[model samples]
Target chain A: MKNSNENKFLSPGHNACAGCGQLSAAQAVMRGLNENIIIANATGCLEVTTTAYPQSAWGLPWIHSLFENAAAVASGILASLKQKGDKKTKVVVQAGDGGTFDIGLGLISGMWERGENILYICYDTEAYSNTGIQASGSTPYGASTTTTPDGSASIGSTQGKKDMLAIALAHGVKYVAQTTTGFPDDITNKVKKALSVEGPSYIQILCPCIPGWKINNDQAVMMGKSAVQTALYPLLEYSDGQLISSSLKKGFQARPAGEYLKNQGRFKHLKDKDISLIEKLAQANIDKYKI
Target chain B: MKNEKVSLITKPNTTLANKTGAWRTAKPMTDLLTCIGCSLCAKICPEGCIVMGEISESAANGKKLKPKNKKLKPKTDYNYCKGCGLCTHECLVKAIKMIKDY
Candidate 1:
């Protein structure tokens, strides 16, 4: 779709948090999409915040399905469109990490296994922000949430983040990409590329949450940028089972993970050992992704 | 008596009727003197509330600037700005400031 100031699919005026990374990423996603699209949104922050009673932020044809059935709904929409012989119209599934990584995985897998023509976009906010900041499967280690508080006895969530990208790749998806809210253009380009593909595509975005991350609202973009620069969440893309592009460059040394962690209250209670553990995690990502 | 069912669909794009600026606790005030009319604030504004228009002479700080290349200034439609302060933070010259909504 052409990027014009006057042509926006996701017009602002919803109840998204100020400086919300998800909303910004959603805007970028909308920019990448053409007018002939139908979106099946899972029940989450994006769905709830955008579609309050009698108001909606989406300019496109949108539907809010059950939290775990967005992929299924999109698959149905694809089937209907195909039956109608509307080859030009696109089908998209938008969901949060809770819906994508945990609740809706089975249905999403089914959609991919069926080789449906759909684009699934997951906004990874780490935790369930809309539901009082509870921990989700995608929540990173050492981050505190209401369900996984960092007290003297605990260092927040004990488990590491689930590798959803690897799972997507394993699903034989032709197009799979991972980006963060730090890079709006990257998100837009990835969405455009995913939409161009004929079969199932998945793009996961690391959208920083203000309340969930316990960071100031203004720090969402900074935190997103830091998350990438620190090598904790590098931008990556895989096309047809091959690594095609990455955001990391040669001689690109990562900033300390603490630089990304220190600004957030979620990691406030982390001890030096915890910070070192997180640093080790970042290092592992750097080594694995070859950033 | 025949029963009537309520239509599930309402008019599309009716969200424009909802004035969300009332939810803002703080409002952004743009400094026309420092603003270079680069339109970064408008580009970064998630609310799509910032509109670029001709700079007024009173706010021009007596620069005797001719309108070249549509030298514009950002005027926010507070009707939807949520006081995110993103525009303020993203401003290259720090031209935008967040003041009390009152």
Candidate 2:
């Protein structure tokens, strides 16, 4: 539809779930991008919903290849731009946590090793939402998924979420940041900052899934904010292997982890003791990242 | 490149043809009197259909207001709203409500 406030990058009418946190976070990401850019999207919910057959919601040049090769595709794009002597247009890679943490990790490491000036954004849904909510490397402990369903004997996923920021830092990425869909402005600003830096950068955004997290449509944003407030997934930024900013500052009082866990069906099976264990995890993050 | 060698690339914004409002079971209606012009709804809309618009004279007719301060309000494009109810839930002043679309 014709309107004054049409989103320049991502247009409306894509088939993403209503109030989808990933889509909303992507909206913010688009706001940070200028017209002179190309995006390499990995196979996931963002790629599937936006580019259907002969239709595309993206207003800019966008490409989708495979789940595990978006970084490679972005590298190729950067190489082509370099060969063409086109220094203006920037390259970016967008992938879900499945693609970033599990499938595309090797290729992403290779890209970072070369130190290509590309921004890699990971939409951390914590599970493979497009594949019917299967647990991935980013799935937090005590959260239920299709593969790690909670039952009489099992308490959902057994492992904790991977520290992707630290891994990105280990690769000597120039910029690394973490944000949630709750903070749209923060996501946009961080995207701008990452693009400003002239080397490999990584940004991971916590995007809640309605069906995967088993939350109400409106609860996605609330859950994202609660995740940060509970310090379960704190807002963080790193520069050249040094901590630049974080949410776990001295004055910050973390909300009880239970407030965030009890709101989602994925964590519904967690007991009081299990909740306490999760609390300890958040506490450890607090201690580890204390400023 | 010849036409026969063309790849299957699509045009930008061609997905606009798919009017997603048909998927909505509810409609968000806003009370302008209580709106504080925050535009949170416009920012959080997944469809990117909500926009901030100037309050028209008729829209502000019933409510008494200082003419010196004209406030902007969120206007949703129903053609793509999808009735997610996020705007209604996140409204700062509880001005938006989700009513049955039927």
Candidate 3:
């Protein structure tokens, strides 16, 4: 389907940055959702920008919950729908990486453990972008942020990104997928696939932040694509406990990780050693996924 | 004065009343002569302010016409466009230009 004009659920007049990858990804997510859907959006860039006081960009039935309670709010909504015998309606919780990997982990786990029928989407911008680009659980290693500034004797963040995908699998979610803004169709297809499953599902989309990543406004899409092509953030999918698909394939000549890092000012501080370290990390993913 | 409770709820679509055009430092001007009428700009616009509309005959006649096919050009709703320039960037023929808003 056409990306534009097909989905009017997420109207476009709000104040997201020009060429905001998250907003583009959100539009793709909307394409997969039907009319009988309700969204519980967590506090983040998406929530703050879309619902600025009296103005709202949401064309669907949506509720803004606290940063850590979107999953819980969705659970409650699902319960109410169940009580009303409304099986046709779907409940979706949309959160940022901070909400999913850190603040809301407990509640998300609780909802998943209860086996609620909900589709949870995490727009992983890699840092707490709304709060001025602070480090979050999903922030990559050696990346500069407000809190993890690269200085003398410092290479930005010291820790690796948290593997939230494994956490979802541990929670026994039936369907889980990871995609980036580079592939809009993949995101839409995965969301549709996740919603088709009977139990809880999860999708994490790598939405490159413009100001946070220190890239030009028009470079978000290109950065997202490079991220996948470099295998730094490979497109991935899992059904039940099995890996159904991964974009990283054997014999596929991977683009140098430096290509992905060089454009963004956030990674400008990286030295040869840091680039190799990131390359090693991507190689490790390739090995693990057998791609 | 009596203490009164205030309701935070406002009517839906109140956002529509807001004319965000004031936020533009640069404005996108579409050059119909260079435009291919591909609608890529309209498709990629983050703000759904761009719409494909019928091209006037006089305006079409002023340009070198591809006589076989009738095409629709995109028009911008400045009331909502924040002048993000996504459309200008996506335009293949360089039809859209971001000029000083004033």
Candidate 4:
């Protein structure tokens, strides 16, 4: 929401460590918005990392609120802006995995059903990364976290990450999509498209966390690209129940999700058969995205 | 309030598909209190955007080089930033955001 002609994000100083894909994913979304846009960021990695107590990395007009209420506050901002004939300013809400899939679900759904023009971007680092690596609804099956510890027969998260895309579609929002940090250009473009659309828009990005996910800072983007290659995460766009463009799959042969997991410490709990299950799950994701 | 932003393009090459690549900007700011000054951003900056500044060379990753100035101030050059954001994204102090002009 920080707006200059060129540097709309106002990212001067931030404390998010390297390999924190949340920063990049968040910046990508902001870069794509109109310079006049205003943003409401939820409490999580993006909030803690960008807006430190005295200073903020934000160059745009941004407000950080309770994790569960970001969408609602953003919705209110949109209404107020429209009421004043400030129709050109775009309103966006940024949330993390914990807020978007768990605590904030009801509010997000309500925003969708209301068909507010807000563009909700979830920078899903896949857990409650700020507090600690705790499993949230967005956490993928077999991934390790504080809650899903690496122990005997305990292959981290047991269920697939909730299908937020499908859920958004069910809400019948004008637009919904999935993206990853490895695909910055695609993510930026989608953000722009969502902004142009007339109704509520939802896009979730797979933001890999360095410390939380137990991956190297250098390996982050490559891991993200690999997730899509392995079908652990696919690139695609959707609207009103119709099929839209699917970002490049590279169809480079679906590597097992285990391959994607191998580089990260989060999935260290996984064993051979458990890894196989992850492979199956990744395949399932690939199959679903093929449409 | 209708939140009014456009959707990100699904295609890869549209003009709207702005690239967020590697960084080459200058002035690698790390949090002194939090940063051990590991020089990770300096090591990762492909363009060598960072340099030794007020702090000793031993204390920082590199020299106190200036960030290439651009349309935006506080010293930012989007021309060189590349958006790789490798420096701040990996900063031990968590200081960096690829904040530059469009």
Q: Which stretches of candidate 3 lie over 4 Å from their true place?
A: A1-7, B1-5, B8-10, B29-44, B51-59, B62-75, B90-97
lDDT of 2 at A249: 95
Strongest candidate by DockQ: 2
Candidate with top TM-score is 2
Question: What stretches of model 4 exceed 4 Å from their correct place?
Answer: A1-8, A248-252, B1-102
Q: Indicate whether candidate 3 or candidate 4 has the larger TM-score.
A: 3
Question: Lowest summed lDDT over 10 consecutive residues: which window, candidate 3 chain A?
Answer: A1-10
Q: Pick the candidate with the highest lDDT.
A: 2
Alpha-carbon error at B7 in model 4, in Å? 35
Tens-digit lDDT track of model 4 for A1-291: 222323335443455664457765665665587667888888897777665555565656778769799999998899899889998898989889899999999999889889889999998888899998888998888888888886766767887889888889999988888888777667888999998899899898988888888986556666777888887888889877776776435354776666787888988767788788778877676666675
| Tens-digit lDDT string for candidate 3 (A27-126) | 7787788888999999999999788887777878889869999999999999999889999999999999999999999999999999999999999999
Segments in model 1 whose C-alpha atoms lie over 4 Å from true places: A1-4, B1-4, B36-39, B51-62, B66-73
For each candidate, the DockQ is: 0.39, 0.58, 0.29, 0.05
RMSD for all candidates, in order, please: 2.8, 2.5, 3.1, 11.7
lDDT of each: 0.85, 0.92, 0.85, 0.69
In angstroms, give how far residue A164 of model 2 lies from its true place.
Answer: 0.8
TM-score of chain B of each: 0.80, 0.85, 0.78, 0.38
List ranges where model 2 is wrong by over 4 Å: A1-5, B1-7, B62-64, B67-69
Residues A194-214 of candidate 2 have per-residue lDDT tens digits of 999999999999999999999
TM-score of each: 0.92, 0.96, 0.89, 0.74
Interface RMSD of 3: 4.1
